[model samples]
Target: MSVYQGRFEGRCAIVTGGASGLGKAAAARIVAEGGKVVLWDLNADALAAAKAETGATDVVALDVSDQAAVAAAAKASEAALGKVDILICSAGITGATAPVHEYPLDSWKRVVDINLNGLFYCCREVVPLLLANGYGRIVNVASVAGKEGNPNASAYSATKAGVIGLTKSLGKELAEKGVIANALTPATFESPILAQLPKSQVDYMRSKIPMGRLGEISESAAMVCFMASEECSFTTASTFDTSGGRTTF
Candidate 1:
């Protein structure tokens, strides 16, 4: 029997980027705990694979950056999951690592579009559904890079910073309601997302961690499960540190 077998007995969650990485980890944990999940991703094959692996209730192949697509998916998610009691916004990309002036304009925009704007769109469309239900948990996956800016990753850092800001504002706005919003700042973890960065940049991040090693996927998923639970009642707008002593703030 699962340790969290009954923690989410009747809950349903929407996990963006659910095909892999932190998102997939979170989805797996939720399902293990008895919650239903809807996997959302841009890759149809990944979505199918994730659905098969996790027994997710549904899958939506979507680009969260596209407002219309996000809106449509939100409706579909509601239909599939019945009600989205939890939302884990784990869809993001580490764009090209470059200094501010050296960063490509297109790449910078793309990073902002996916990491920041996509999150905004997902929240924008889903928050109302959550509010109508009168209860919701929102876990936005940020990075330690946002808190302590990395040397050559301007766009990624900026977008994650935006996520933190957005979470704080959303939490305050919904404090009186039954909805809660928060962000998670995690250090480099062993996941597919790590392959997007250069080895030099990856090594640089690992060196910065006081733990002397990269984070594990389970560590992140554990924190996400807690934040997505009713146990996280008093922590809206707060930032959870999963950064292995890398985040001091």
Candidate 2:
């Protein structure tokens, strides 16, 4: 039996960026544990593919940076899946790899919009539904860069750092309300997003990590699954690091 055996048997979960990478892995695990999943992604093709692959009926194409779109997506998810018992905010972008002063303003804004604002929109819209049901679990995907800022990636690092702060604040606010919120900081992972970075940047990232290798999607998914389960009831407003010894704090 799975750790989430009967925990989320009939429950519903929402996973942003679920079309691929960490989000898709989490959605797959949720379904394997007997939970229904509503996958939200900006990529329609990827969304369709993920739906077909996971056999998940609930899929939505919407930019998480758009607050109104996020609201609509959440409503649609509730209508499709009944109620959202778990939420995994994982949508993000690598942004431009350049010095802070040399970084393009547009690129920086876009990264922050997707990584930080997108998360805020999802949490803001989903929390109400959870509060109404009197139960909820949230796992926000952050990064090791958030804890220790990475050079040449100011936008990505800053936005992830903001996610950490937001998770902490929300966790505390809902601590007594039966809704738990937490953040996961994973080091460099072998994700599709990594392809966006240049080889030099990738090398720099790997060199800094003590693990000497990128993390696996399944490894990150396991941590997310645990956090979204009822077994993680007591912990809230905390950062769970899965950096393969790279995270020292």
Candidate 3:
């Protein structure tokens, strides 16, 4: 038997960026614990692969940055798995690394659109559903960079910081309504996103972690699963750090 042991039995969860990496890990764990999950991602092929890997039939190919698409995906998830009990906003991007003054406007916009704006759109659409059902857990995947801004990655850092702020605000707003919002900050997790980073950038990230190693995806997923579970009811609007001692704040 799993340690979670039906902790989320019969619950419905939607994991954005579920096509790969930490998102997929979370989805698999949720399903293993008896919760139904909808995997939402922009890559249809990756979504299909994740569905197979996790045995999740409810997969939606939609861009999280599009408000209409997020709303539609929310509706589709409800239809497929009933009301959402847990929402994990894991979709994000590691934008080009450049000094703030040299960063392209488009790159910054794209990062903000998907990382911060898209997360809000998902929350906006899902919170009501949770409120109607009288229960929900939302875990936004942020990063340590959001807390301690990283050099040459202003856009990524700023967007994640926005997510932290949004989570705090929403957590307070829904404190008495049975819906909780929280954010997770994982540092230098071993994932596909790291592959896109330049060698110098990657080394910088790795060196910043006091642990001298990158965090495991499963370690981060464990924190996410705990936050999403009914057992984590008392905490809200707080940021949980699983950054291998990289985050002292």
Candidate 4:
């Protein structure tokens, strides 16, 4: 929230799930900070609207869960932005709200496919490009649920945990390559993703937050932009918290 004027100047980024919520918020901020972004999301209509709203350089519509689609998107993104200096993988879903004993098999797979494998695809594709440039930043959006598993939301929690692990491993691999990768672990936040959960589940998450309120988009966006900026020079493979006291470690 402090003065980050032109912090991202001349940078080009690829933001997945850029159609709504925190992803869209981060895109707008990146543009405000003098950077260009190519937005990617599954919804074509939403992608178009977000592109207009965020001043994004271009938009790609494809399901992140599809490996082929993700690879193609990365190529298209590179062509659109000329080069990618940053990648923000924020596409995910909170699948069925059922206990592990009763969870829907298909729903669980869907969540993992998008939240974990999809993100992996994006990182794997873009990392080479980042190494080629000799400098890059990656912010993988995870969740506190990953650290403190949520009951009845095993799939979501598990996938986010996988995201954290992938980011850590990636950070270490690229630490000497000038390409840094980190994960963002936000608590219960006011995101459209919440719509996927039931009210009881939402309230349960809110109660666990010491602040007794959901996180703000601006709050998380600030942390996100910081992690994706040159200011995050010394940190990689670490988890940045924006949980309003929910995560004290």
TM-score to native of every candidate shown: 0.98, 0.97, 0.98, 0.98
Candidate 2: give its CA RMSD in angstroms: 1.4
Best by lDDT: 4
lDDT of 4 by residue, 34-62 (tens): 99999999989999999999999999999
lDDT of 3 by residue, 1-249 (tens): 135888889899999999999999999999998889999999999999899999785999999999999999999999999678889999999899899999999999999999999999999999988998899999999999999999999999999999999999999999999999999999989999897789999899999999999999999999999999998989999999999899979
Whole-model lDDT per candidate = 0.93, 0.92, 0.93, 0.94
Considering lDDT, which of the candidate structures 3 and 4 is the better prediction for this target?
A: 4
For every model shown, the clashing-pair count is 0, 0, 0, 0
User: What are the per-residue Cα lDDT tens digits for candidate 1 across 105-128?
Assistant: 999999999999999999999999
Candidate 1 positional error at 35, Å? 0.3
Clashing pairs in 1: none
Could you give candidate 2's per-residue lDDT for residues 213-245 as a string of tens digits?
888898999899999998898999999988988
TM-score of model 1 vs. true structure: 0.98
